[model samples]
Target: METNMTLYHGSNIDFEKISLDKAKDKRDFGRGFYTTTIREQAKEWAEILNYRSRRDGCFLYEFTFEKTDNLHIKSFNGITEEWLNFIVENRLKGGVQHSFDVVIGPVANDRTVNTIGLYLSGDYFLDEALRRLEYFKLNDQVSLHTEKALSYLKFIRKYTWTA
Candidate 1:
Protein backbone atom coordinates (compact mmCIF):
# COMPACT_ATOMS: atom_id res chain seq x y z
CA MET A 1 0.00 0.00 0.00
CA GLU A 2 2.66 2.48 -0.95
CA THR A 3 1.06 5.74 -1.84
CA ASN A 4 4.05 7.37 -3.49
CA MET A 5 7.30 5.88 -4.69
CA THR A 6 10.11 6.34 -7.18
CA LEU A 7 10.30 3.97 -10.12
CA TYR A 8 12.94 3.26 -12.75
CA HIS A 9 12.67 2.10 -16.32
CA GLY A 10 15.63 0.77 -18.28
CA SER A 11 15.61 0.97 -22.04
CA ASN A 12 17.89 0.56 -25.02
CA ILE A 13 17.11 4.06 -26.19
CA ASP A 14 16.09 7.38 -24.64
CA PHE A 15 12.71 8.82 -25.48
CA GLU A 16 11.02 12.02 -24.39
CA LYS A 17 7.61 10.46 -24.40
CA ILE A 18 6.20 7.31 -22.88
CA SER A 19 4.12 5.54 -25.50
CA LEU A 20 2.08 2.46 -24.70
CA ASP A 21 1.56 1.83 -28.40
CA LYS A 22 5.24 0.92 -28.76
CA ALA A 23 5.14 -1.50 -25.84
CA LYS A 24 5.42 -5.14 -26.87
CA ASP A 25 2.44 -7.38 -26.25
CA LYS A 26 2.37 -10.63 -24.25
CA ARG A 27 4.21 -9.02 -21.37
CA ASP A 28 3.81 -10.01 -17.73
CA PHE A 29 1.35 -7.18 -17.12
CA GLY A 30 0.13 -6.82 -20.68
CA ARG A 31 1.11 -3.99 -23.06
CA GLY A 32 1.94 -1.06 -20.82
CA PHE A 33 4.77 1.21 -19.76
CA TYR A 34 6.71 -0.76 -17.17
CA THR A 35 8.94 0.45 -14.37
CA THR A 36 10.50 -1.04 -11.29
CA THR A 37 11.11 -0.03 -7.69
CA ILE A 38 14.58 -1.58 -7.76
CA ARG A 39 17.38 0.48 -9.26
CA GLU A 40 19.85 -2.40 -9.63
CA GLN A 41 17.27 -4.52 -11.40
CA ALA A 42 16.52 -1.68 -13.80
CA LYS A 43 20.22 -1.21 -14.47
CA GLU A 44 20.60 -4.90 -15.19
CA TRP A 45 17.80 -4.69 -17.69
CA ALA A 46 19.55 -1.75 -19.38
CA GLU A 47 22.79 -3.69 -19.56
CA ILE A 48 21.11 -6.70 -21.10
CA LEU A 49 19.26 -4.62 -23.66
CA ASN A 50 22.42 -2.69 -24.42
CA TYR A 51 24.23 -5.93 -25.10
CA ARG A 52 21.48 -7.00 -27.45
CA SER A 53 20.98 -3.96 -29.75
CA ARG A 54 23.36 -1.26 -28.48
CA ARG A 55 20.75 1.27 -29.70
CA ASP A 56 21.17 4.79 -28.31
CA GLY A 57 23.06 3.31 -25.41
CA CYS A 58 21.64 1.96 -22.17
CA PHE A 59 19.31 4.46 -20.48
CA LEU A 60 17.60 4.38 -17.14
CA TYR A 61 14.67 6.70 -16.80
CA GLU A 62 13.44 7.69 -13.36
CA PHE A 63 9.89 8.57 -12.53
CA THR A 64 7.66 9.05 -9.52
CA PHE A 65 3.98 8.25 -9.17
CA GLU A 66 1.47 8.44 -6.39
CA LYS A 67 -1.29 5.92 -5.95
CA THR A 68 -4.80 7.27 -5.76
CA ASP A 69 -8.21 5.80 -5.06
CA ASN A 70 -9.47 7.37 -8.27
CA LEU A 71 -7.51 4.95 -10.44
CA HIS A 72 -8.04 1.25 -10.78
CA ILE A 73 -5.05 -0.80 -9.71
CA LYS A 74 -4.22 -4.47 -9.43
CA SER A 75 -1.54 -5.53 -7.04
CA PHE A 76 0.09 -8.90 -6.42
CA ASN A 77 2.19 -9.01 -3.29
CA GLY A 78 3.52 -12.50 -4.00
CA ILE A 79 3.28 -15.45 -6.29
CA THR A 80 -0.09 -17.11 -6.12
CA GLU A 81 -2.45 -19.13 -8.27
CA GLU A 82 -4.22 -15.91 -9.27
CA TRP A 83 -0.97 -14.15 -10.10
CA LEU A 84 0.20 -17.15 -12.10
CA ASN A 85 -3.05 -17.37 -13.99
CA PHE A 86 -3.10 -13.63 -14.68
CA ILE A 87 0.39 -13.78 -16.18
CA VAL A 88 -0.47 -16.87 -18.19
CA GLU A 89 -3.57 -15.26 -19.64
CA ASN A 90 -1.75 -12.06 -20.54
CA ARG A 91 1.17 -13.92 -22.14
CA LEU A 92 -0.95 -16.34 -24.11
CA LYS A 93 -3.58 -13.82 -25.13
CA GLY A 94 -1.20 -11.05 -26.19
CA GLY A 95 -3.24 -8.04 -25.07
CA VAL A 96 -4.71 -6.23 -22.11
CA GLN A 97 -6.84 -8.65 -20.12
CA HIS A 98 -8.17 -6.38 -17.41
CA SER A 99 -9.42 -2.83 -16.85
CA PHE A 100 -6.89 -1.81 -14.27
CA ASP A 101 -5.13 1.46 -15.03
CA VAL A 102 -2.02 0.30 -13.22
CA VAL A 103 -0.68 -3.04 -12.06
CA ILE A 104 1.89 -3.57 -9.35
CA GLY A 105 3.30 -7.04 -8.89
CA PRO A 106 6.16 -9.47 -8.69
CA VAL A 107 7.96 -9.73 -12.01
CA ALA A 108 8.60 -13.12 -13.58
CA ASN A 109 12.29 -12.43 -13.99
CA ASP A 110 15.04 -14.68 -15.36
CA ARG A 111 14.82 -17.02 -12.41
CA THR A 112 11.10 -17.61 -12.84
CA VAL A 113 10.74 -17.33 -16.61
CA ASN A 114 11.80 -20.92 -17.17
CA THR A 115 9.38 -22.17 -14.55
CA ILE A 116 6.61 -20.09 -16.08
CA GLY A 117 7.51 -21.41 -19.52
CA LEU A 118 7.35 -24.96 -18.29
CA TYR A 119 3.93 -24.36 -16.86
CA LEU A 120 2.75 -22.73 -20.04
CA SER A 121 4.09 -25.60 -22.14
CA GLY A 122 2.42 -28.19 -19.89
CA ASP A 123 5.77 -29.51 -18.75
CA TYR A 124 4.99 -28.36 -15.23
CA PHE A 125 1.68 -28.40 -13.41
CA LEU A 126 0.28 -25.56 -11.27
CA ASP A 127 1.44 -27.01 -7.98
CA GLU A 128 4.85 -27.74 -9.48
CA ALA A 129 5.09 -24.27 -10.96
CA LEU A 130 4.29 -22.63 -7.64
CA ARG A 131 6.79 -24.86 -5.90
CA ARG A 132 9.50 -24.05 -8.43
CA LEU A 133 8.76 -20.34 -8.30
CA GLU A 134 9.37 -20.33 -4.56
CA TYR A 135 13.07 -21.04 -5.14
CA PHE A 136 13.80 -17.71 -6.83
CA LYS A 137 13.56 -14.14 -5.60
CA LEU A 138 11.10 -12.02 -7.54
CA ASN A 139 11.29 -8.37 -8.52
CA ASP A 140 8.53 -5.79 -8.42
CA GLN A 141 7.13 -4.08 -11.52
CA VAL A 142 4.77 -1.10 -11.81
CA SER A 143 2.98 -0.95 -15.13
CA LEU A 144 0.93 2.04 -16.30
CA HIS A 145 -1.89 0.92 -18.53
CA THR A 146 -3.77 4.06 -19.44
CA GLU A 147 -3.29 7.72 -20.32
CA LYS A 148 -4.74 8.68 -16.95
CA ALA A 149 -2.37 6.35 -15.21
CA LEU A 150 0.55 7.63 -17.27
CA SER A 151 -0.22 11.22 -16.35
CA TYR A 152 0.41 10.53 -12.68
CA LEU A 153 4.05 9.69 -13.33
CA LYS A 154 6.42 12.65 -13.22
CA PHE A 155 9.73 12.26 -14.94
CA ILE A 156 12.60 12.89 -12.54
CA ARG A 157 15.67 12.39 -14.69
CA LYS A 158 17.41 10.00 -17.06
CA TYR A 159 20.73 8.27 -16.47
CA THR A 160 22.84 7.01 -19.37
CA TRP A 161 24.46 3.76 -18.39
CA THR A 162 26.48 3.53 -21.57
CA ALA A 163 28.57 6.12 -23.34
Candidate 2:
Protein backbone atom coordinates (compact mmCIF):
# COMPACT_ATOMS: atom_id res chain seq x y z
CA MET A 1 0.00 0.00 0.00
CA GLU A 2 1.08 3.55 -0.72
CA THR A 3 1.74 6.10 1.99
CA ASN A 4 -0.79 8.39 0.37
CA MET A 5 -3.88 6.81 -1.16
CA THR A 6 -7.18 8.04 -2.51
CA LEU A 7 -10.32 6.77 -0.77
CA TYR A 8 -14.01 7.27 -1.45
CA HIS A 9 -17.06 7.22 0.83
CA GLY A 10 -20.45 6.88 -0.74
CA SER A 11 -23.75 7.79 0.88
CA ASN A 12 -27.22 9.02 0.14
CA ILE A 13 -26.64 12.32 1.90
CA ASP A 14 -23.95 14.94 1.54
CA PHE A 15 -21.90 15.54 4.61
CA GLU A 16 -19.04 17.81 5.60
CA LYS A 17 -18.01 15.51 8.40
CA ILE A 18 -17.44 11.82 8.94
CA SER A 19 -19.09 10.87 12.21
CA LEU A 20 -18.65 7.49 13.82
CA ASP A 21 -21.73 8.11 15.93
CA LYS A 22 -23.87 8.26 12.83
CA ALA A 23 -22.45 5.03 11.48
CA LYS A 24 -24.31 1.81 12.05
CA ASP A 25 -22.88 -0.84 14.34
CA LYS A 26 -22.33 -4.61 13.88
CA ARG A 27 -20.48 -3.93 10.65
CA ASP A 28 -17.55 -6.00 9.44
CA PHE A 29 -15.09 -3.79 11.31
CA GLY A 30 -17.48 -2.50 13.95
CA ARG A 31 -18.68 1.12 13.97
CA GLY A 32 -16.28 3.32 12.02
CA PHE A 33 -15.87 5.56 9.03
CA TYR A 34 -15.50 3.30 5.99
CA THR A 35 -13.94 4.23 2.68
CA THR A 36 -12.91 2.26 -0.34
CA THR A 37 -9.89 2.50 -2.62
CA ILE A 38 -12.00 1.43 -5.58
CA ARG A 39 -14.17 4.18 -7.07
CA GLU A 40 -16.65 1.78 -8.68
CA GLN A 41 -17.19 0.00 -5.39
CA ALA A 42 -17.86 3.36 -3.79
CA LYS A 43 -20.33 4.21 -6.53
CA GLU A 44 -22.13 0.93 -6.02
CA TRP A 45 -22.35 1.65 -2.29
CA ALA A 46 -23.78 5.09 -3.03
CA GLU A 47 -26.41 3.61 -5.29
CA ILE A 48 -27.39 0.98 -2.74
CA LEU A 49 -27.58 3.56 0.05
CA ASN A 50 -29.63 5.91 -2.11
CA TYR A 51 -32.11 3.20 -2.94
CA ARG A 52 -32.41 2.09 0.65
CA SER A 53 -32.98 5.66 1.80
CA ARG A 54 -35.48 6.27 -1.02
CA ARG A 55 -33.30 9.14 -2.17
CA ASP A 56 -32.95 10.25 -5.75
CA GLY A 57 -29.21 10.76 -5.74
CA CYS A 58 -26.12 9.98 -3.77
CA PHE A 59 -22.86 11.65 -2.89
CA LEU A 60 -19.43 10.15 -3.32
CA TYR A 61 -16.92 11.83 -1.07
CA GLU A 62 -13.26 11.53 -1.89
CA PHE A 63 -10.43 11.71 0.56
CA THR A 64 -6.67 11.50 0.58
CA PHE A 65 -5.24 9.24 3.25
CA GLU A 66 -1.74 9.85 4.56
CA LYS A 67 -0.61 6.75 6.37
CA THR A 68 1.85 7.16 9.22
CA ASP A 69 3.54 4.73 11.55
CA ASN A 70 2.40 6.69 14.60
CA LEU A 71 -0.98 4.94 14.60
CA HIS A 72 -1.73 1.25 14.80
CA ILE A 73 -2.99 -0.32 11.59
CA LYS A 74 -4.38 -3.78 10.90
CA SER A 75 -4.52 -5.09 7.37
CA PHE A 76 -5.90 -8.33 5.89
CA ASN A 77 -4.89 -9.07 2.32
CA GLY A 78 -7.73 -11.58 1.88
CA ILE A 79 -10.32 -13.51 3.81
CA THR A 80 -8.62 -15.91 6.18
CA GLU A 81 -9.31 -17.82 9.37
CA GLU A 82 -7.98 -14.99 11.49
CA TRP A 83 -10.00 -12.41 9.59
CA LEU A 84 -13.14 -14.53 9.93
CA ASN A 85 -12.68 -14.88 13.67
CA PHE A 86 -12.03 -11.16 14.09
CA ILE A 87 -15.12 -10.32 12.06
CA VAL A 88 -17.23 -12.75 14.10
CA GLU A 89 -16.11 -11.15 17.33
CA ASN A 90 -16.95 -7.66 16.09
CA ARG A 91 -20.27 -8.58 14.51
CA LEU A 92 -21.57 -10.74 17.35
CA LYS A 93 -20.32 -8.43 20.04
CA GLY A 94 -21.11 -4.87 19.06
CA GLY A 95 -18.23 -2.59 19.98
CA VAL A 96 -14.65 -1.83 19.09
CA GLN A 97 -12.85 -5.15 19.21
CA HIS A 98 -9.33 -4.00 18.45
CA SER A 99 -7.07 -1.05 19.20
CA PHE A 100 -6.04 -0.51 15.60
CA ASP A 101 -6.69 3.02 14.41
CA VAL A 102 -7.21 1.82 10.88
CA VAL A 103 -8.24 -1.60 9.53
CA ILE A 104 -7.91 -2.50 5.89
CA GLY A 105 -9.72 -5.62 4.75
CA PRO A 106 -12.34 -7.21 2.56
CA VAL A 107 -15.95 -6.13 3.11
CA ALA A 108 -18.29 -8.95 4.07
CA ASN A 109 -21.08 -9.20 1.58
CA ASP A 110 -24.69 -10.24 2.32
CA ARG A 111 -23.96 -13.92 1.77
CA THR A 112 -20.96 -13.78 4.02
CA VAL A 113 -23.01 -12.06 6.69
CA ASN A 114 -25.63 -14.79 6.41
CA THR A 115 -22.97 -17.42 6.67
CA ILE A 116 -21.72 -15.79 9.81
CA GLY A 117 -25.22 -15.73 11.19
CA LEU A 118 -25.51 -19.42 10.46
CA TYR A 119 -22.25 -20.05 12.19
CA LEU A 120 -23.43 -18.08 15.19
CA SER A 121 -26.74 -19.93 15.27
CA GLY A 122 -24.98 -23.31 15.23
CA ASP A 123 -26.15 -24.12 11.73
CA TYR A 124 -22.66 -23.88 10.28
CA PHE A 125 -19.20 -24.59 11.60
CA LEU A 126 -16.13 -22.35 11.31
CA ASP A 127 -14.86 -24.33 8.37
CA GLU A 128 -18.27 -24.13 6.73
CA ALA A 129 -18.40 -20.35 7.11
CA LEU A 130 -14.92 -20.04 5.69
CA ARG A 131 -15.85 -22.25 2.79
CA ARG A 132 -18.96 -20.20 2.06
CA LEU A 133 -17.02 -16.92 2.27
CA GLU A 134 -14.50 -18.22 -0.24
CA TYR A 135 -16.95 -17.89 -3.10
CA PHE A 136 -17.25 -14.13 -2.87
CA LYS A 137 -15.18 -11.74 -4.98
CA LEU A 138 -14.51 -9.44 -2.08
CA ASN A 139 -14.07 -5.69 -2.21
CA ASP A 140 -11.65 -3.69 -0.13
CA GLN A 141 -12.71 -1.43 2.75
CA VAL A 142 -10.48 0.84 4.81
CA SER A 143 -12.13 1.57 8.14
CA LEU A 144 -11.07 4.42 10.40
CA HIS A 145 -11.95 3.34 13.91
CA THR A 146 -10.69 6.37 15.79
CA GLU A 147 -10.72 10.15 15.63
CA LYS A 148 -6.95 10.04 15.25
CA ALA A 149 -7.42 7.70 12.32
CA LEU A 150 -9.92 10.12 10.80
CA SER A 151 -7.33 12.89 11.04
CA TYR A 152 -5.17 11.22 8.42
CA LEU A 153 -7.93 11.43 5.83
CA LYS A 154 -8.26 14.83 4.17
CA PHE A 155 -11.46 15.53 2.35
CA ILE A 156 -10.66 16.13 -1.30
CA ARG A 157 -14.03 16.52 -3.06
CA LYS A 158 -17.56 15.20 -3.50
CA TYR A 159 -19.43 14.06 -6.56
CA THR A 160 -23.20 13.87 -6.88
CA TRP A 161 -24.35 10.67 -8.55
CA THR A 162 -27.89 10.30 -9.81
CA ALA A 163 -29.91 7.18 -10.43
lDDT by residue for model 1 over 61-153, one digit each (tens)?
999898888799999989999999999889889889999999999999877888999998999999999999977888899999999999889
Badly placed stretches (over 4 Å) of model 2 are none
Clashing pairs in 2: none
lDDT (10s digit) by residue, model 2, range 100-151: 9999999988767888889889999888888888889899999999999998
Candidate 1 TM-score, true structure as reference: 0.94
All models: lDDT? 0.90, 0.89
Q: Among all windows of ten consecutive residues in candidate 1, which has the lowest summed lDDT?
A: 47-56
Cα lDDT for residue 2, candidate 1: 46
Residue-level error in angstroms, candidate 2, position 18:
1.5
Per-prediction TM-score: 0.94, 0.94
Steric overlap count per candidate:
0, 0
